[model samples]
Target: MGEGNWARVKIILRSPASRLKGVCADARFSGPVGRPAVAPVLCINGPEDKLFRSQSADITLSSEKERIKKMLSEGSICEMNLEVELFALQDSNAKLVAALHEANANVEQWKKQLSAYQEETDRLRDQVADLETHGGHGPSDLLKDELTQSLEELESLLKAKDEEIHILQSKKSEYHELERDRGEAIHRLQELEMRNMDLERRVQNAEQTLASSLEERDRAENEVHRVIDILDVKIFDLNDLRQSLAKLIDK
Candidate 1:
């Protein structure tokens, strides 16, 4: 058996043995209050309880053997899968080796082609220099005229580019000035808003002060009316006393 199968078999065997030991221990420690108190049986043939325990142990062993057989079969399957993977890896490695050989052959062919191209380029350059040294005067004059015309066109294009750059610079300056004016306007607007808030607060405070003064004036007017009413009552009582004295004198 493989190592994994052997380990599983050992675990299965140990678990049942431990369980049987626990069962025996529980029976030995059982109390007489819960279990019936009976004398031990001594038979000439065999003990009946021992027979029952032996049958249970046989059943447990058979189950464990079946589990071991199943684990061995699984392990064999895993080995076969590992073998298939190893063969696939070997085939891939062989293909990679062949590709590397093909690439090396391609590199050799490219080197040969590059060498041939370099030889042709050198031969053409030599032919061009020889023609320039010994060729006729008429073709050279034509080439010089073409070169002068090309230089004049290039100079005119450069002047136009410089003028365009200057115009763009002036426009950029105007844009910066506009940006500065916008920032100033925003700052001024913020200042005006703050001033408006301060003015509003002062107006509210003045209104409150005016309302308090009006309340104090109304209270003073009411007190003055009360004093005038008391004075009029005292004057009427004096006039009645004077009239009674005059009548007594006449009688």
Candidate 2:
């Protein structure tokens, strides 16, 4: 965890065989000569966010240079904590889909019940007609009351079912929209991850190239210094020979 200006971390990695610094650059070591090639940086400002639970610390990274320095000094991290959070988000999305499916199933069941009620109403009407045809008289008070009561009850039940369907439909639509938004979010995350991977690879390549260039430059400079020293020595010998020839001529 990043406490103050410096962060605390534990990592295990072997130093590259080509490393100029023969000693392993682990956290236990000290100074520029013993620094590790790679160090993990605890990101104070993560893009996705909610990774760390931090108390209010007033560590200000106010400049872009500072941010870059921090990023380079200690490389980025992709941790178990972040993965667990993403998995939780995915699980929540799945539960939402399941709930939507259940609501849709409920809607279908309500439609079936509604159809059954209509069929029953038709059957009652047919019975009423058949009795009227046989008796050629009006319906009995008890029969009229019962038929009216049944129709009224059916109407109320249908209204309630309609309201339920409306509510379910609204909820289903909401879930679908949420699913679409989540799909977009996942797509964005995939693109960002790919870009980050590409950038990290490029950075590694750049560092290798830079180190090689610096080594070559230093070798060239050393050769130049050796050549200059040799030329100076020859010049000194030439001056001594000129003085000897002058003395011989004078004698």
Candidate 3:
């Protein structure tokens, strides 16, 4: 049987055996329970040299008149204070033992809770890493929209450049036919030079457009890095919280 239940039995059954039954020592129940159980401690007033000849721990207070106390002469109701003191010691011991058992159980429960918290924290960290990988270093909606806008702009510029390249090739073909009509004339030579100048200008514009597109790509990369840093900090916070809770549980 549980020690708590055993203690309760002793308290309930002690009434028929002694002047007063043993009391429950539960501090939590003390408001409803008035007194601690009174018990007898055998202090042999005999010679110390013979102390170990016999050691008796059990005592039974049979009735108001014929009760037995270990340390007291059998029929002597010597001191009220001594009787009260003995009972208090027994009650204190019972209460303390019960408290220790409760504390041990509580510690085990705390350990389980701490373990669960650590597992959850680890899972959240893994999720954060996955998000950083797929979310382009940033998981926020604003960053996502910015990246999308940049991609659209780059695609538009690329399509426009493709059309310009096509137009340039057609112009070059037309210029080649014009060259065929030339007859060692200065007008034809000047026209050819103007066509060459147009081609060079197109090349320069294409380079400038490519440079702007590269800048957009770099900005997008920076935003992604910034978001990754944010996730790292949040992960650290989660770990710290888990540790703190674990420490509390240990205590």
Candidate 4:
């Protein structure tokens, strides 16, 4: 058993035994037979004395029984307290165990990360060694310088190309605007041409109407001249008839 449990057991046994010893002492003092007198002879003479002694013995016995009961109750309370403490300790131990498990899991994760880092470090070292073996130190330095110069040239070219692209984009916008203006001018020219065709057609129709009017005017003038000549001949005939009539009258 654990030290705490053992101590609790000892306490449980000790209290009851001590109280029993006190009870035994009381029983011995209350005995009426086979025991020596503890008081003076003059003090134990008559019926009153016997009654008093009996009452004293009864009181002592009752007090001893009560003490024994109290001791048993105290022992039971101690046992209950110990049990409560044991449960509390068990709960604490379970919590500690859980915490330890969590800590172990964290440690394992860190170890994995550390291992991956170590592998990366080894790879880098190997790459450095390979680079060293492939070329002498001066060659590596020259290669580094060449790579840096190439990068700078590439960057400069990219910047120049970007500027060219910007200029082209601006020119493209201007071309688009010019194209739109040309389309508008073409549309206006088409409208003017249509208007000119309509005006030409109107002039042609007016000329045809004017020709028909001229032909009708000539026909009317010729009919008028023929009528005037016929009138002149009739007048001359009437004058001749008048002269013939005058000669007959004279006869």
The lowest-lDDT stretch of 10 consecutive residues in candidate 4 is 35-44
Output candidate 3 Cα RMSD. 54.5
> Which of candidates 2 and 3 is the stronger one according to lDDT?
2
lDDT (Cα, tens digit) per residue for candidate 3, span 158-192 = 57656755765665565454444332333444554
For all predictions, the C-alpha RMSD in Å is: 50.4, 23.6, 54.5, 77.9
TM-score of each: 0.41, 0.52, 0.26, 0.39
What is candidate 1's lDDT per residue for 41-159, written digit by digit as tens?
A: 22322323344444555465455545555555555555565455555555555565565566557556655755665555466555556667788423355555654565555566557
For candidate 4, what is the TM-score? 0.39
Please identify model 4 stretches exceeding 4 Å from their true place: 1-141, 238-251
**Location of the lowest summed lDDT over 10 successive residues in candidate 2:** 52-61
Deviating ranges (above 4 Å) for candidate 1: 1-135, 138-149, 245-251
- Clashes (candidate 4): 0
Cα lDDT tens digits, model 4, 1-251, are 46776665456435875445434434434433233344212221343344454455556555555655555555555556555555555565556556556655755665575566556556655655677788654336655565556556556655765675576566556556555555555555555555556555554554555455445445544554555455344433433333333343344
Higher lDDT: candidate 1 or 4? 4
Segments in model 2 whose C-alpha atoms lie over 4 Å from true places: 1-89, 217-251
lDDT of 3: 0.46
TM-score of 3: 0.26
Model 4, residue 21: displacement in angstroms? 99
Ranking by lDDT: 2, 4, 1, 3
